[model samples]
Target: MSENNHAYTLSDGTSILDLPKVSLHDHLDGGLRPATIIELGSEIGLELPASDADALGAWFAEKSNSGSLVEYLKTFDLTTAVMQTSAGLERVAREFVQDLGADGVVYGEIRWAPEQHLGSGLSLDQTVEAVQSGIEQGIADVRAAGRPIRVGQLVTAMRHNDRGLEIAELAVRHRDNGVVGFDIAGPEAGFLPSKHRAAFDYLATEFFPATVHAGEADGLDSIRSALLDGRALRLGHGVRIAEDIVIERQDDENTYVTLGTLAQWVKDREIALETSPTSNLQTGAIAAWGDELIDHPFDLLYQLGFRVTVNTDNRLMSGTTLTRELSILADAFAYDRTDLEVFQLNAAASAFLPLEEREELADIISAGFEGS
Candidate 1:
């Protein structure tokens, strides 16, 4: 489906695209506009797979759909290539927020590694500042257009790199400016959260919040490390936690299951699972179960009482949005508007905002759904 198309809907025919939403796992580098990529590539003398916006977008979808993590990641080399300078970062960040607003996202956390943007001699702090300035401009532009939207930064460190502590400190340093949280991205299999012990320890000492990318490409052990070592307040696309679940039986009336300790902890603690349906399929995050969306453990996790929040891990790569993700899940699981609202509430509660602010967001979501 085209990125502009709505992939799911409410029972009463309400467009899922019109519903208020919260995007928790969106990546700043993973969501560049195709036209913007072409323009930025022209400015930087970078080669693109396709010169036209639609064809370039289709190229991203094809690469991401290859079911190879390496192939999926190769697409980002092109995106980050155009995002080295301050102007590039600011423009991309601004467009990211504007796109999220256009897709009915009321609040979002845009995560990206500053280290990746320093190829042009910009400091890590300068990169963060540029992105934040762009985010502010995007917010102003959205407000001027009579749309209400809010965005925060989740400064990310490369899990495969040795600068976790430095990045964690950078995130904390800008907590009041625009950064709201810390995260670790990149290869997730061998580079466990325990590898970044000193960084997590420093973040703990500073009482800073973190959300680790675990249980996506990796399994239960990585999730355990995220909680025990990283002290993660949330799990980024922790969809693989379903590996810990054992399904006993299923009938028309009921499905019986058992949960392992790790799954139980995630359920009891309500650590938000940033489940991205299309991205999960593309990255093989849900390959243990099946290839289709219905085969995804998202419904199983939700039924098992995990705090499941729908997300679009990479909008451009997956050819998706928060609205499209929700729509696809609803279509797969036969979910109604109430189920969709529950997912939004789950995300709002798990957001890194103050409790009162989260409550306000919940109120907005509730009102929006009610009006719909």
Candidate 2:
């Protein structure tokens, strides 16, 4: 888990890590290599909780595993501490893409709040440019190794902050550069997407895509706000949308259920639910149903035809990869190769890329799954 690249397998003896995948919910600050964090901490003269790489990574896991929201979020303070300067941001971004490439990700959208990185006086544009440069370098590095990766930035605005309009503008400004779409991360309970209606309105006018972090820390109301106010094309860990579904009864013949208006909208509209299995458990996002992977509503959503996509919300904190996430789900639900391929295809379709590129991604995924 300390190393971002980890091999996974299915019961059928297929190499999960070798399959082409798409990542739409990964965080740039959450996927840093422990070694990189240690080195960057030293350069910035920032005091770290742990001096060694292993210990530092362990510290992150420990904090994130505490199940307390406040404690879980404190881990980011350390990761973002060293990511203030341009060089640090660029380096971390470079390594992030490289790690994703190693994990067999053909396309990924890394999300991070540029507003948080302004502590070191780097302008918002500079931070975006630095990360884009790193991503390009990482792509080149992967190509040099005879593999190719395509990555884009999901410029994020902290939902709890009032910088939504500014960040939204920044994302639109960099639309042609490397920024592919926009997102709203951070605390989601009290800070609903409606709080940033103006920003979403502007994005709608500009016809930009967005994916809001809803139904993770909050419930149906938050998801409603995401669709109605944020105009989210996808739901960032929209796992809690399951809350709106009422199971009337279950039997050998049938399992009866009813979907609330909100749930029906999300499901029928095919809004992608970026469900992160491990992160959901660690963050208490799935505590309502149960405390294990088997209890996740991912299978239910997929069976019900929601555009369910597998993702690693925070790789370092959750100690997982896209490969590992798929494997975990496969084991929990007894999913087969076709099931895993459906998840990949769902992600490819949900990607914020142009329709043609998304179709290209779908073709790549279909071919890979078929070849396997």
Candidate 3:
């Protein structure tokens, strides 16, 4: 019913790569090509864990499966190391857009912390410019190849660091450029979003949008901080929000459910959950539920009418594309093309674009799916 020979396909024989998709939580530093890393690492005299591109890719995939968020995040050091220079950042950004296009992404928001890439003496603004330049080039590349694709930047601040307010200002300053949103990414357990309340408040005043990383390495209280203090429009890897739901009982054909106040608020507001299955499994975000993809609360949330969007949090580390993510979820949850279309529609609506643009995206997705 399905094939994975060269391209990903669904049970109905629809090529997943031909479907229009929108990505919400993709990380810029975490999606680099393995060959690019080797070349860039060589320029800076950095020793790689593997010599060849395929093995280096395997190395990243192997290292990221450690089942600890902290341990899984250590892989970013190698990626960020090569992304310090302007040229390096530009090239990576350019290629990232191309890769997403190839994976059938019509629109995507690439998030990264500029602070982490400042080691090469590039100012925060310079890093943003370099990335924007590459994104534009990549857009052109995709268009030239007869594919429609667009990407925006989500400038992120390190939650464990002290430059939250500064990073927020940088994100707002470039709002007209490639930047579309702001975020706080890093260890999520102790570094609550409230630690950057001032930054969130500034963003609130300027009316800049933000999506906080919460409910992944932390629990309900952290998600609460992200909503109450950070005013996050979306929750990054918010699979743990499932903890707030209490399944009272399940009959032969129906299951009774009770949602806590936090879960109710998220559902009512339609705040998106950027759920990355492989990344969640690797980071132990869904460990309490189960270790496999089926154990992910993704189905529970989606079935409960929560706004859940599939994402590739880190393509390289997870060794996954968006098509692969959707395909695996389909296999695990027995979802058909309609279900897949809904997921893409949810993502299109949740994108940081304006209402009209989001509607346009939804139209595009609907048309693509209808055609398929």
Q: How many residue pairs clash in each candidate?
A: 0, 0, 0
- Which candidate gets the maximum lDDT versus the true structure? 3
* Per-residue lDDT of candidate 3, residues 1-372 (tens digit): 022424667889988878999999999999999999999999999999898998999999999999999999999999999999899999999999999998889999999999999998999999999999999999999999999988999999999999999999999999999899999999999999999999999999999999999999999999999999999999998999999999999989887899999999999999999999999999999999989998999999999999999999999999999999999999999898999999999999989999999999999999999998
TM-score, cand. 3 vs. native: 0.98
- In candidate 1, what are the lDDT values of residues 1-372, reduced to their tens digit? 264546456667989988999999999999999999999999979988899999999999988998866678888999999999999999999999999888888999999999999999999999999999999999998888887899999999999999999999999999999999999999988999999999999999998899999998889999999999999989999999988888899999889999999899999999999989999999999888999999999988888789999999999999987887887888789999999999999999999999999999999999999997
Worst 10 residues of 2 by lDDT: 1-10
As for lDDT, the candidate ahead, 1 or 2, is 1
Candidate 3 clashing pairs, residues 3+ apart or interchain: none
lDDT of 2 by residue, 1-372 (tens): 644333468888898988899999999999999889989889888888888888888888878987555567778998899889989999999999888888889999999999999899999999999999999999998878877689999999998899999999999999999999999988888999999999999999999999999999899899999999999999999999999999899999776889999999988888999999888988889989998888898888888889999999888998878988998898899998999999999999999999999999999999888887
Model 3: CA > 4 A from native: 1-6
Weakest lDDT window of 10 consecutive positions for candidate 3: 1-10
> Residue 324 lDDT in model 3?
92
lDDT, residue 310, model 2 = 92
**lDDT score of model 2?**
0.90
